[model samples]
Target: MNIIQQKKDERTRVVYIHIPFCTNKCFYCDFNSYVLKDQPVMDYLRALDREMEMTVQAQPPGSISSIFVGGGTPTVLKPDEMQFFLNSVRKHFPDWDENIEFSMEANPGTTDLEKLSVMREGGVNRVSFGVQAFQNELLSGIGRIHNTDDVYRSLENARAAGFQNMSIDLMFGLPNQTVDMLSESVTKALELGLPHYSIYSLKVEENTLFHTMYQKNQLPLPDEEDELNMYLLLMNRMSEAGYRQYEISNFSKPGYESRHNMAYWLNEDYYGLGAGAHGYIGRQRHVNVKGVNPYIEAVNQGLPRLNTLDIPREEAMEDFLMVGLRVLDGISRARFEQQFGASMDQTFAAPLEKLVHAGLLDTTDEGYKLSSKGILFGNDVFGEFIGSLTGN
Candidate 1:
């Protein structure tokens, strides 16, 4: 069956809106974003509003449990622009869960008290700041426009604006990052006493400045041993600071886990709107047009989709294993059977046994999960589940 027919009755519970404009692009980043210069900003917002309006008319949503406005720095929008965008969201997806988690990604230097007030009044309850490092040299090296002072000032303003539920992102494997440098960054992040933190290793993705530097040996990144030590140090420190490692790279204090991101790791269906956004519904995945003008024009005509394809059963099973295993609690056997109508052991017995014997996966009462050792080599463990089902 085609994607539309299959997903016609599916009720999307999570909504992700992309605002693909940033103050400046980071060196190691490769997401679909453009500099906030000479672009038709209001025109893009109007195009997004039209997309949301048409989306709900086609496949109406249930009580939305989570709404995440991620970006190229969503806070780059002016107060009035933010107001218009949020109003459009409320106009379409009006029915929200009582305890909905509304989150927007902000850059350290972009957010201010006035814009934050607009966000809070518009129903945003959570704000995540992209404060990649606390060191000024590291910040400049990464091509980030914000410095350490902006980080402190932004957090202060966020708190002043009544935003208590906040999180900050940090990076570990940078060009000149060492174990001690990561420790200092972690110390500063914990000192803020926020509810959640997301620290990720820097990957030199293609088409980025960092990738080109790496190819020429200009990027003086930490070696494998140093990077491993850095990861271990941060993990130990976060645990010591009383944060739960709910996912591989996310830590939260008790009830502050990001529900919007958890929805993705749990493989739930969500609406992805705006230019260059991707959405998954029923058993199909689709990506919207990447170019801003092209997307706006397309949505004016109809849905601004570039391509949509149905995910095959085998590929879906592999995805379930791959994404589900990223969570600390791991995949559940009963839920797997409910989703695919087959026993987990029956489908993946060979690889499961292999990983179990290798001490990479431990069998739980409900299902299987990564061992402490397995978390470090997660790619290898996830790879075991990929082609094994087809072989059997």
Candidate 2:
């Protein structure tokens, strides 16, 4: 902690707000969200406002650099609800950076011109639509309500509403999905020439309909080779098309990277507001109550946090390595040293040496980054640092 380092530490905060209501939940999804029908929508918004007030009162906030509204499909909110929710955000966290990257996660078919117009006026400068895939069959099989037409209409509506910094999500591995199918999806996605794309392999997390089918050997997922090919194809395609693989699953044109996600990869402190949202600040992290009713009730009493934990220094170091490496540019040695007040070389010498020796990690003049091969086998590369210091 020298004077200059202290001066540099005054970085702005990132904000994540969760709206856990969806018109419908996709089968492969396990996010903390519920069906929108008959829910106490207005009550939840008010509860969210109260939670935000309490949160700022406790720790306060610096100028907000990014605000990402995610989950269940934030655009599912009606025009009026959207206005109130956005108003709550401005009321509590008014200090916005002039160039703040305010992003809202939208689902196709859930947004119309009117809804999007409300969002743009509410300080949202970016919108990411979850298109998942271009083919109608894959979308239907996955229980998504939106079709290819809906995706087009949604993007057109967003653009019509004065949005240019938009992004879309595409999925790779899924039941009965082929390499050709994925290739087709990629082709269609790139054709739009959007500023950003986030393509991910399916993980079939527990508690999802897909997970249940997997248990019964009913989930006909793509074979490993096909999945590998899909990943490789996307990497090559995005690169050739002039998009940077900013992070493992995300691609964007120069300067179009999602700043909110960058905050997570850098393991920086961010305010996570709303039900089931997670926030980390100063080595302490809190998860809000997951259920909408439970969250609203909790907020009426006080902060709606389900639990808060002080992240141990060793675990935090491991996390720093895990998340930072996801970025193509990798982590910085100076950052590690400044945050932990220790040399990265001395802290995890053996693991670093091992990974670099295996060609999974490469040493940069400033720090370390994943090698070209390391990108494909990222899970394995990250695994090496999981317990570098702590036995677990």
lDDT measured at residue 196 in model 1 versus the true structure, 0 to 100: 99
Q: After superposition, how far is residue 333 of candidate 2 from its true place, in Å?
A: 0.4
Best by TM-score: 2
lDDT tens string, model 2, 56-123?
Answer: 88877778899999989898899999999999999998988889999999998999999999999999
lDDT tens digits, residue span 1-392, model 1: 87874553358889999999998899998998999998888999999999998888887898889999998989999999999999999999998889999999999989999999999999999999999888999999999999989999999999988899999999998989888889999999999999999999998999999999999989999999999998899899999999999988999999999999889988888999999899998889999998889988998899999999998877788788888888888889898898889888888888889999999998999898989999899999989877665553
State candidate 2's TM-score: 0.97
What lDDT score belongs to each candidate, Candidate 1 first? Answer: 0.91, 0.92
Candidate 2: segments with Cα more than 4 A from true spot: 1-12
Looking at model 2, which ten-residue stretch has the lowest summed lDDT?
4-13
Positional deviation of 149 in candidate 1, in angstroms? Answer: 1.1
**Clashing residue pairs, candidate 1?**
none
| Model 2 lDDT at residue 343 | 92
